[model samples]
Target: MGKYEQLAKDIIKNVGGKENVLSLTHCVTRLRFQLKDEGKANTDVLKNMDGVVTVMQTAGQYQVVIGNHVPDVFKDVCEVAGISGGEGSGEKVKRKFSEAALDIISGIFMPSIGILCASGILKGVNIILDMAGLIPAASGLGQILAGAADAMFWFFPIILGFNAFKKLGGNPYLGMTLGAALCYPALQGVNLNVLGFNVNATYTSTMLPILVMSFIAVPMEKWLNKVVPDVVKTFVVPAVVLFVCVPVGFCLIGPAANEVGAIINNVIQGAYGFSPIVAGILLGFLWQLLVMVGCHVLVVLPMMMGLMAGEPQPLMAVVAFPSFVQTGAVFAIWLKSKNKKLKTIALPAWISGIFGVTEPAIYGVTLPNGKQFILTCVGAGVIGGLSVLLGVSQFTMGGMGVFALPAMIDPANGSGSIISAVIVAVAAIVIGFIIAFVTYKDKKEAVIENKEEKLVKGREVICSPLNGNVLPLSEAKDDAFAQGLLGNGVAIDPADGKVVSPVDGTVMTLFPTKHAIGLVSDNGAEILIHLGMDTVKLDGKYFEAHVKQGDKVKKGDVLVTCDVEAIKAEGYSMITPVIVTNTADYLDVVEMASGTVKAGDDIISCLN
Candidate 1:
């Protein structure tokens, strides 16, 4: 089997098997799974497994922090375990506030982000054409492109309806139909012109009304599906549902919701008018946090509606700061990290950030590391607040990106809001650099533990048996290591003539070649110690052992020590692998007191 595949299986089993999982999802750097029963999970066991950064239960998902390679690991886990659905269940539903927030943010922004980015890029291209005089102000091409760009905003409900429906476990087509009723051409033409007053009742591109309509539609559809008789339920229920839902959705639901949505919008608009800087600071700092909870899209809808009405919404400008700030933060990390692997990841994250794709940056670099992410948010918020004071405004309906900046610029009004956007962008970048620079102390790099050193009772230590550069299991040369088959562990080599027990345990097995040993600790944890890098080539030769399979030993007991220099002279890396063969049962793995020593020192301390 491939390296990662084997490793995935080992980790999966360690986490209490596929049945233990209730649901599974992935962000840029983590595989978020919910367990069927947390009581049965050994998170600490999973955490110490090779290639894992940490394990957290938050926002209803069991998160495995595996960094940029999470998707690959997730896929491997699902395939091996025959997982069909996305979430794993525990005995009861448990809530994780942080994960819930993150999940919400992903839900709200991830769906339409690609569309907005594409539109922004196209808008930029159109601006270029206009600047170069290639497309006249009234050119058909310009109009067509502009119209294409506006289409998504105008019909955002239809798009959101599908996504929201999926999120809520309802049929998307029905949800879409419910949204279409609100913006239907005939319904939009219903205007009130009484007393010689022309008041537009247009609902095109409106956000709040359609969302309100969805709340009703989802429940109404669910009731209908449940109540309808078996045979004719499908046909009869849909027909009846459409007849009842469409009319109500338009007549009472859409308009009333529209009015309510407008009131909320008006309140925000008035507040912003009173203090743009305050609004910008609040919005910029909180926008990403809102995304984490899936409510950010709710904010986007109102802005889209303002765009549809051809009004320059201050909310648009307020949000632009965070989008740019995420990029700045990622760039700072990319420039600062000296690790080649981290540098490789940070580069792509930076590129994605430029296109206004912040998920990769947020998950891959920021959130995992903790401090850099907080700095990004605070630094960006400051820039946004300042931009508000500078009277920066953007007319564009799309989210932040260089392509959207020109659309924000208004030649007719000479608003100079686009310039404000530029200042904020530049300021945010500067702030991010300062924060990251100040925080960029090179922490300890990845290290593998060796098994041939001293061990004390009741102490935690890794017994790595091979020697080579400590590669992350995800990047290991061996298929078993790559797939996490060996558990939360690292590759190491025999540093001396003897291998010793890092914990008090019974020897489970001693391979015939004396190249590998398996032990079960008193705490019921299983460990494997494999000697030498690429020792499979030695076919277990030149290896000797003091202990046999099934012998009970205390911590620091002599197990096996090999000729390290001789092994190296024979062209094998003395790198070893110390692993918890079963890891998925716990909550996390914590590295104990550090500053390095020889073999058999405490390495990974488990937390349940």
Candidate 2:
């Protein structure tokens, strides 16, 4: 089986099984699901599952945040669930108009975002190379690179039509045919007169025309499917769909949508033309907020439209500074925070933000601490205003963060715009770092016990939770555990089915599946005992918990019991990992036991 196959199966089972899913789609870091009944999902269970970051419900999407590897998980979910093209039949839930619109936009745009970013980066790189005199604009290599960069935008209508039609529950190939007709070379710059009405428009590289066509085609295809006979309906429906949609798109939808797009572009240009700095400040301050709520797509669609029209996009340029700003805030948190757990989250989040992906920074670090997030926004606004004042504008859509600098280099203006971009980026980081470092304060934990009076002093021992042969965590099957992403630990190949408390502490987290338990020792070592690899998929069938969350237990007290033979019969390995989840808080977590052990024996030592 594939690496994520079990994870995918577990996810599908917890989300009310495959029967409850209406559709499944994904973005860079999330699996977006449209469920037939949201109430049926075991949300808490999924949240506690390994490999999952968090769960969110917004804009009618049940979002499973899965980090950067979401695409792989998404694929496995589709395959394991037998989902074809993300389409499933179920009763529709009543939703607000705004919610419905947001859902549709996310469904249509998110699937293609990766390729769009890649193409934009390629275009930006080509421009940078040309400006450096490494390649002339008219050279064969430059021309080839330009074609590769421009292909996605030039054929955007086809891509949009395919996704939009599928999202609307219509035949996608018919949508593609309509988009092709709109983009046909011979039809460009054409004027057609029908019944004394003149239809004149250019449709290549446009979005609205195909979107409108997809909307109209859904109902049209539905009606045709009902009236036409079954055997011939296969060929007939498509033929009729293309025949009607192509003409209506060219004569009516194409001209009207193009006009609307032009009006939107002109209005945005007029607003920026009035006061660029004000526009920049507003976008910079509010952009991350919009992303947090999943509403950024509304702004992105228009910006993409403007870019395809060969217009300079200052709005996108202004918004790009927030990633660096978020990074700066994370750096401050990493440098100043005493909480080891928060520091671990901050460091990776800071690295991700540099690459222009700020979700980790926003969700993992800054937003949880309100002051840093606000400071980051304030820094972004200040830098954004400065960027516009310095005349920084993007001539093409590009990758995020520092990578976006190349797109700001306007060949006609030499390197002046790119220089301004660099200045804005550096200023954003500096301002964000200073503001957050100066203003941010870690919340003081309420002291429950006097540290000096504790028996353990600056050291603690973790007793064996299971009677088993000890194994280094490096030899474990899962990379997350083996590599210590979940924290440093040692694994045990269990010889018994029972789990005992290794320390005197309260239960910190107890998974609904009974396959994992988290404990916080009185001496402050946070430990996690995961029952087995991929055992969460058993859904509590072969496991039982002796204690609930928040229960206090002494060392050697029974915490959980497992049906070892039954779990193994079902193909799950019974190797449990006893991890110090907050390993960074201590100087070292030294494995003390080697070959075999009894439940009450000391297995590891935590030194402070």
Candidate No. with top TM-score: 2
Please state every model's RMSD to the true fold in angstroms.
8.6, 5.5
**Consecutive 10-residue window with the lowest summed lDDT within model 1:** 588-597
Predicted candidate 1 versus true structure: per-residue lDDT over 1-608, tens digit per residue: 33467557756776678878765666545666666666676675565445665676654556676655666787888787777335343234555676554554444335566586567556655665776789855698888987887777677777767655655556777767666666677657666464565444556676655566666667877888888888887777667767877666666666677778677668768988897777777787887776454345557656666665566776676666675677777777778776444455567667767655565566556765677777787876787689778766556555445555665665454336666767767787677777877785544423345575332334345433222334444444553454443455554433366777877889987755677778888887778777755564565677778999889998778888677777788987665666666654433333333233355555555444
Per-candidate clash tally:
76, 0
lDDT of 1: 0.64
lDDT of 1 at 288: 71
lDDT of 2 by residue, 246-290 (tens): 888888888888889889999999999899999999888998888
- What is candidate 2's CA lDDT for residue 184? 89
